[model samples]
Target: MKPSKHTKNQENSRRNFIKHAAVAAAGFMIVPRHVLGGKGYLAPSDRLQVAGIGVGGKGQSDIASFAKTGKADIAFLCDVDDRRAANSIRNFPRAKYYKDYREMLDKEHRHIDAVSVSTPDHNHAVQTMAAMQLGKHVYVQKPLTHDIYEARKLTEAAQRYKVVTQMGNQGASGDGVRQLQEWLDDGQIGKVETVYCWTDRPLWPQGISWPEPAAQIPKELDWNLWLGTARDLRYVEKLVPFNWRGWWEFGTGALGDMGCHLVEPPFRILDLQYPKDVQCSVGSVYVDEFKRGYFPESCPPSSHVVMTYAKTKKTKGDLTLHWMDGGIKPERPAELEANERFGDNGVLFIGTRGKMICDVYGSNPRLLPTSRTAQARTKKTIERVPGGAEGHYGQWVEGCLAGYGKMKMSSPFEIAGPLTETLLIANLAIRGFDIREARADGKGYSYPGRDLKMIWDSQNIRVTNFEAANQYIKREYRQGWTLGV
Candidate 1:
């Protein structure tokens, strides 16, 4: 049957929309509009206006969480890849879209009250500093910055700009952390002296050479723009849409990935700050029969970094923190039954009297010995965040509307900044493990710097004993990519 031209065009439009929607949903979640908002719901002007940069994967979920708060207007979405950004575009159809965040900020900064940054570790500092410079509230994902310098600067900028800042480690606002603090306050775990945090991460590749032959860049992704603060390079397969965590340029490895979530409880309860000294051992990857690959461009497959912190008001003396990543775990405590779980990702606190443990995101906190978790319940001295973990988004939303420092936050920069530095310091120790230099005789490489404990002068921001380790404290940006702090 011959159809009218209008009908044929309408059919084409429907098919095109469906095809485009499906592609966006290919690697991302395509949430229904009803899930984001219902009818008769006009987002209020008083509601905080948020523009998301790098809106995909965790970024996508982050903006959605903010929207679900009913107090945030997701007014703008930005991403380097259209395919990765498709779902967010669909969820926030009314919001404007852009490929570069700088352009969005240039044009829509006036409209945006706050910005949420969920980009890679490398871009975090530049994007965050830019937003702060614009006097916009910011909700940045955890391990605040790729370098120690950036973390310190962002922490300072938040104060100077008088803008509310929240790190995306929502556990900072969770009941788990509050509960840990309460347990500490009640003296259940008296004067914690030793701590252990572990995670099974790098579910991505690490300790490998850069791909020799570059793969064709995806049509959906702007490879150059995606490189943001990283060095110029040909598009490599599997580096995008995820797996960048294994690379030193775009990601901070497992410690940066999970440390913020697992380490915050101990940091909060024990009032821990920058470590005084750090040392680490990393698992070596063997390329063949007799050769071990020390791919300078990649992080280790596994690492065990140990950091020593000076006594704080909450501690008895010098406390030791152990961070295990890349599937390495600490020896199981005798208190836990072999049959029971110690959690795939968790933190353990050892004190004068007892021990406590918690899972990732600081959830399911408990005193060791399954029975003690219930038996030794402390009074709820610390107030709980309403709605618990999910409240993190709302807490930031309310705080943004209330002005900087008006309302308490779960992971404010003041708190998160120092916490992030803690992990980066641990990372410095990890990076130090593989440091190499040509032998004085010029025969071969001599890893003289290896196995040395880095002495950190937090005030000066340098590794006093090992000059080579200080490089990680503040990485030089690639050409044309300034941190802008």
Candidate 2:
């Protein structure tokens, strides 16, 4: 858990900068903010200085949202691809740009008060951990980390470093989730027994083989940096900007992409924690009429994962949660009329008394009977975020300013870590579905992972029933890359 040499140098640089800043400010007379620039004017030092990693697409909006808070200054931006970073660079013309996050942290850590990580799944742990080690508050995008081990480490680091931390699952801050929680608390849905969360994701290709003849690397991209923590591989066309979600090496498939948003409600309302066991069945692809294609390098086309969690205080008994992706959905509840539509992506909570459903991000929650939705009334006991989901960014900025443990954040590492681990644990079952071994007779193959249930030892962070599935828990980093803990 010792800091790396580079981290140590950054810490020293931060100290020196603070010392010089104080000495330089000694010559200036203290003046009221109103005298300097009229009323309600904030001095530069009053704003939170933020450095954004992977500043493109979601990253662009994430940093922009923070800046919109008027309490944070976008001071730096980092991305492996210049093309993706272009919009962010133009939007925050005053922000310094860097291709490597390590370089940004080394040279600019002294100036950054917070870091926003909107990178690929594989790089989230390292990048976020780096910022946290420098005592910079962090807001990382959803799923937290690519692996359960990484997720656990980041969770522990947040507590160890005592820095304000928030995960990018904005739904945790939405009003819909609070309403759902209030309903459950009021026993509107008495003693939940089962939950189903589904998403029509993986719009990108999956269950397919890797592209043959690697495509030419784009001039604007640094392929090595983009592949940080993942195995070194040649660039393939259509993999940048998006589509990486389909591949196991660079992305985490549909579950990782959408699970945080959809599963978060049940996780919060039910007070669920680590799953006891998981089993899954996946849709397959065929290369021809005779052979079913086996592409272990890619995620399955579709999957249905079932996980069992011991009952929490709110539940009457053990709870079963089903997660389906790639356009699959659960059976509709009979309470709905034939004309009613079940959402393409939604969550269903079945309780002893009734059922409730909601769209992604816990939005538009309604009781199953539909008629009951309007009639149902519950106390507004749970506090709501100022602007609901849109307030997620400003909440984090304010929390950082309030300092650790001073203010509450909707999806801090304490909650996001375990939620992410649960999804990744389910993925172990999905990925294990294809672990094939050559038959001893050398005639065919034996798929031991098929039809098998993985028993997880949460404390140990491994699957006790299947050894092969544990490989995905923590991946070996590529050379020159480290999680730094």
Candidate 3:
């Protein structure tokens, strides 16, 4: 006899809870309730007050999207760098401006309803955590946290506080990703064993070298505040404002930057919970006058990281997901036909029955034989992935206002949290030590194998080889600027 819906739901919930518990214990820990409050909601009748931190690049784009909708008031604008924050300031003249986000939150907590964090990876957790603690909803840029530990905390905060949360992986809301899920559910790629995701990132915003020593710090910028929770380091122009993506301290290199967009479809379609093991074969690290004490290791700066996920009864046994970053990609699989080689960066799903391939936007996705038989089988089920409408930022605004909306948010902490954890670990792997090692805090992980293969205690979010990698997790916070829930 079939189980009742309630029983089935209970069983599913129990299993999912166990899975999350196992992952949390071994990976990272999050306490959202400590940060986000569950006392209120922004009703549809309410006009949402929004703040923005780090107002350049993607942040500017996010601001425009928010402006498109009438539901939100851009009330606060903050950024460590004055120049970068200028445009956004002008964009919202009615909004108050500040250089430090913490000050903005502390002073304006009573009035603000939500915040958008589009800063460097290192600053995301602190600012977002601060806002959530005051019961503010948050929309953070992709790859949510700089370290695995922050991801868990932010996830918990979002859940515990009941604040509306979204990650800026815009592609998450794309109709294409949803269709990718439908395809997987319908068994288009039978008995999936492997997934290959790649990207053309590090193209513009990537490949920057390490910083040198402290030079004359810019007057317009608050160098100390910029460092925030990171270790104290000399300021370098190349490492600031924009070029931080290539640095070890500020960015997660290529993987952390692009994995959320490139890898989301597979993770969603395959229903990825957590990988049993993660290993990386990174490229050479390079040097720049900008990269002296700032980054310790050099040579093989880029990498090809391979993450392995063991199966639950739901998955097809062990699955290997390979990720390439910083312009390095794996060679085309030998099994493909002559013309079937992949493009510069895309996804390839190899299952027992056949294969499926697509790009980040999920266009030109075609199955093998690339013709009628595949089309006949897939057409009835094939649906166009929604193009970005309402956009990610717009969607967040709607959600924040409690507008009756069903727009899918790509970077909801539920998805962004794990995605961030997986990508952040790649950085942990390359650093050869967890960022928190300098501290005796029970946070961070270690890779026992030289190849950077690690077995994580997901419940505690600790690495089995903590002795080696723990050093990279938490860094020395600048005085008066530490981040805590």
Candidate 4:
């Protein structure tokens, strides 16, 4: 006799349950939410699995901050220098360690939900791109990339891969920037027309020739891997750990080191994008009374770069940004008392009606005249990040768990990419200042790049007038390295 439809349905359901139960009894485990949803998924109860590349110094602090969130597990640590990584190893004894990021990514990509890259400038692009390609959320140190081209590519990749990304400019998440924003929104400062960002960085060294002698490679460090995308070169004393900041090969100089911290407040407050034109003058070192020291390999001791941006929603007209480094600073605002300290590292916004100033990381924002800070009362329109600057790591971790596009990030790649590009473009003009060509008479070199206002075609990412300056927009990687775009 034919079975009733409901009875048949019940029988089918029982058969399916028995099949699944049998499979379970045979030692097959149920797939986890992460496994079923792919690498991007994280069950609410599960902690984010994080892999840290260049896990030393800032990288060490970055992972520690993430772990502080109590919602992340520092599962892996990769650093070329074991000595540099030793502290992190002790901090996260359970975290597996590797000398090469590529190897770590290869074997453990499935286990890692996110990656933090705190390596030197040159390696930033390749390491970041590799992780983003594998579906890992990334928190990269600023300036986001060593070159302008890398910044653009990583920005596009972050969107294409649909991964949450935050640049490690913790200042972007600070409450101080929000206060400045609120003040601007309330017309307390009026429309900002000019900005000055300055830093006294390069305390390591700059405007010098590369050390001639190769130093003994540290026993615990893998020198070859440390070089990464940088041109194969002999290791020199002090270049490791920190002095690399002054060199063109591995670092982005003072502007790169502190620009993100100082320039970021103005960049965010004004809604500025790429610059239409940039020109710079760099302080020079003299070999003697007659000859100037020409160390093209090193960043200048000081530079003043002027970048002009077309009008934005936050501005009444075109905006001018001045970036000063190597202890240089803009002239003190007339409103600021002579005795009032203009911070060594600070940002000054000169609006039509008034001026606002803030120290590095956009901290201690106040009106130009110290007395006005107390009188100004602006509504808090922008929500402050929990724990302010310190919350940066946790913010990214939470965003990753929430899935892409679910949460808003303070320094997401969308904002950071252009901010980074802006600083690098200033570097381009500073580098261009040293460009020299063989004289037609063959007596000496002609410095044509000097005193030139580089007209930037932002769409093409090139300096239209100076063909020589264009070479720096994107550098050729060492033979084996690729951005993997």
Please give the CA lDDT of all the candidate structures.
Answer: 0.89, 0.93, 0.71, 0.92
lDDT of 4 by residue, 1-485 (tens): 99999999999999999999998876656567778879766564578999999888999999999998878999999999999999999999999999999999999999999999999999999999999999999999988999999999999999999999999999999999999999999998888899988988879888999897888998998989989888999999989899999999989999999999988998888888899999999988878999878999999999999999999978879999999888888998899888889889999998988999999999999996889999987888899999999988889999998899999999999999999999999999999999998999999999998888999998999999999988988989988899987
Report clashes for each candidate as comma-separated counts: 0, 0, 57, 0
* TM-scores for every predicted model: 0.90, 0.93, 0.79, 0.93
Cα RMSD for candidates in order: 14.0, 9.3, 15.6, 4.0
Show pairs that collide, candidate 4: none
Q: How would you encode candidate 2's per-residue C-alpha lDDT over 66-156 as one tens digit per residue?
A: 9999989999999999999999999999999999999999999999999999998889999999999999999999879999999999999
How many clashes show up in model 1? Answer: 0
Candidates sorted on lDDT, descending: 2, 4, 1, 3
lDDT of 3: 0.71
> Which whole-number lDDT from 0 to 100 does residue 286 have in model 4?
71
Which is the better candidate, 2 or 3, if ranked by lDDT?
2
lDDT of 3 at 66: 84
lDDT of 1 by residue, 1-485 (tens): 89999999999999999999899887468554444567644446567899999899999999999999877899999999999899999999999999999899999998999999999899999999999999999999987999999999999999999999899998888888888888888998888889999999879999999987889998889888889888887788899977898899888999999999898888888888899998888888988898888897898999999899999877779999999988899989999997989878999999998998999888998887879888985788888888888899999999998998799998999999999998998888888777888888999798755678789999998899988888888877778888675
Looking at model 3, residue 11 earns an lDDT score of: 99
- Measured with C-alpha atoms, the lDDT of residue 406 in candidate 1 is 94
Worst 10 residues of 2 by lDDT: 26-35
